[model samples]
Target: MLNLNRNSHVPWISAFLLIISYSIANGVYLTIERVTYYPIFKSDFTSILLTIIAASFMTFYNYKRYVYLIPLSLLSFLLTSITPLILLLPIAYELRKISSIVGISLLITSSSMLSWVFLRLIANVNTYFSLPLMLITAGVPVLIPIVWFIGIFFLFMPNKKGNKDSISLNPLIPFILTLLVSLLPYLPYINPYKFPETVDFKYYYSWLLHPQFDGWFFYTRPFYLILLYLLSLIFKPYPVAFYEFVFLSVFYVYSGYKLASALDRSIASLAALLASVSPMLITFLYSGLEANLFSISLMFLSMYYLIKKEKITLAIILSLLSMLSHIYAWAQISTAIILYYVFRFMVSKIKPSKYEVIYLSSSLPFIFTGLLLIFMGIFPVPMSLANYNDLIYQIAVGSWGSSNMLLFFIITMLGNRFMKNLLGFIYAISVLGTLVIQPATNLIIDLPLFIPAAYALRYIRKDIAILLIINLVLWGIYMSINSVPKIH
Candidate 1:
């Protein structure tokens, strides 16, 4: 129950005050806690403060574009800081604020902050440093959600504008060549069968427990994994880890082509290629997060269907499948549905029907699952619900070695050009989050995929490709520094 209605600036100012107050309060508490008891955590206030500033800048930049969300975002951020016991109580309050930028911003910002703080507190670390503090504090809770907010906004932002897209496919061969070269790294690394000592390798290797079970059992849809495994047979019978990367890259490329075709062919092709080579996709080359690969592809495919055929039911089904594939897929699913509804409402000149609303509600079950897992901690498997900090250890090398990641994060967070492109912003933030939470290689692979998919933004934003390449190069540097043998 934070109030912003008195005036537009009131909530924003209030939020700023709240954050400053909380930071000081939290810092003082930490100092006292340490002095009283051999404090379990040493606060890295330098890193924490830096992360907050960076994250605040990123969030502020994005929220400024849709200024209405600031109050809600600020409110949500404060609420999340309160104990988790009141999580449900705040739901109704947030619901009343939903349509405005304030509500959506609050939702996104609060979720990010809550997730960040939870990871920090639950990890039971002896010291709090800038890296983890910024990561969970600003990066996860605020920046990522801000990106999500922009994406959702773009999808539904009432295209009150029109355009004539005539960027013909110039030099298709060159485009394909660039895409192939960019993606060449994903081709199976010459076999060393043993999992490389990177962060997410073990999480994926867990699947080796049922290597013969077919990843299809992992989810209801088998087409994605099945198709990838079969294609790998044509090459060498590599581990599904390699195949997941290959298939996701190809599918991401094709999906971008399909989505971009709605705008321009060359742009779509470039976007597709960028997606194929992005850090996110590259990381998947080794992480074996097949579900992420599969579901994202399906989400884009569903968008293609919705735009082209107006196949609402089919689109809904695909979206649901995408949601089921992974918790992360929720952002994509929500963005797509929101865009579809907004488009139909505007173009068809009709209010949303009951069915339209119901169809959109399909995403709720997944949301519920996430909430249950996050708040109640009623997870199905203890391993699946392993504290998010585990991702730090599992994906350590790819993320950064303390200083490296923090530095890279500072440079990227402050300088990432894609921040202007809402989708690119989200992708950029996501890559950082993934680096912190998952294995380094997995993040490396997955970054490219998410970048291109983000282009589904209705506006033909060229910055998407530019920013993606920047992230890609940064990731390459990270890998080169690691001196992990390049299996090429």
Candidate 2:
């Protein structure tokens, strides 16, 4: 497992790091603000409540099963905070250094590494002298983003060896491949000089960068906005390109790999390899379609659990997450799951079993949410005939460009193949419908096309598939690098 000795008190990560940090900062800040004027909280209700809940959970969880514990981020915070005190240097100087590009990178990386190490060091806390230290560097506003990165990093490195209830990360091939594949596109966009490349992207960067979450932006897509809001705090001084790398890194590892495993477990790696390099995937990853990206990520993950496995509860929860991400994608995901049920029923000529009925019932809330959105006249993207042909072009060829015509031809040829698995067929059909439902969402071909394309690849001769991988990877890299024309 991730435990160091299985007796440590500091849960894998310093569970209370975020809440405790916020409590320290916001508690003091709010008290001053209240004396100045009462606009928000009378006390630190927000942070306190979260802190209490997190503290309670950690307390209860560590009671019976103490995983190797280390105050992963806490130790780094000690180094960041206490060192200056010991050396008799002012902490403000250290804080200034800590916020630099190198400093921020170190904090982020240290949190991730220490989280892994802390989970590893879960046991033998007495040996380390267990203080359950969850301190921050007094006034660092970087805690939220640090915690966010550490949360996602846990997925990047899962505990392969676990107890009976522990997750099975078997067949690590797809998981690892998908992580690399999903990460490939955003590398080129990370240049400091490059702007967000689109007007919408610029607006989103601004909207989330602000401390206040004003506007209907959050109302429409709370999931993506909250994530972007946290990221905005981290990458505010930098270009939006940096934001894309972090956002996509956390999102697509689950989406891409799970989508592959959902379709066909044996060929999951090949599926991820194919899906990650899709022209559409590469294109939209840079298009500033935050809600779409997050929705599709959840959609793919939900699909993974439901398709090959029978994790109804998880599928339902993730489907709801997708709904919160984007109504259109949720609509597609809900219907796809329901239709998969119908497909099974049709083939068997029998009614759905009890749990299957429960699964179907999960779509009711989504339907209501979708209808509520319509009645409220809060359409996310205005439906128009204008984006139809453009959507098709984007799905097949990715953006308007003559350079990828060869890639276009190949994707189309491969996309035409029929999926062998029924769920794969249903998902492909569901995503195919997105081409017409909304213009922008059609750009999300990675979740839909990744698996079927991989299935089609299986039909090819081994030598040809190898050639196709190389060819696709080169084009994928090319597409990624040239995705958004760099603004000087």
- Candidate 1: segments with Cα more than 4 A from true spot: 1-241, 263-266, 307-309, 330-332, 335-488
For residue 431, give model 2's deviation from the true position in Å: 6.4
Query: What is each predicted model's overall lDDT from 0 to 1?
Result: 0.40, 0.46
lDDT of 2: 0.46
TM-score of each: 0.43, 0.54
Model 1, residue 298: what's the lDDT? 74
Model 2 steric clash total: 11
Q: What local lDDT score does residue 279 receive in model 1, on the 0 to 100 scale?
A: 39
Model 2 C-alpha lDDT per residue in residues 1-488, reported as the tens digit of each score: 23233223333222334324343433211111001111222134444443334333344445343212123223323343222222212111222211123233324433443443343234312111111111221122223222212322332232233112211234554455445544533444243354343325665656655645544666667776776666656766245434564456445654776676665566566655655566445545544465766787887787677655578889888878788777765765576666666776798686777766776687776676786775567755554443544543433233432112233223334433434444444445544454345554343343355554565456554444444555555444433433334343
Q: How far off is residue 376 in model 1, in Å?
A: 4.9
Tens-digit per-residue lDDT, 251-304, candidate 1? 666765675554445456545544443434434443345666677777767656
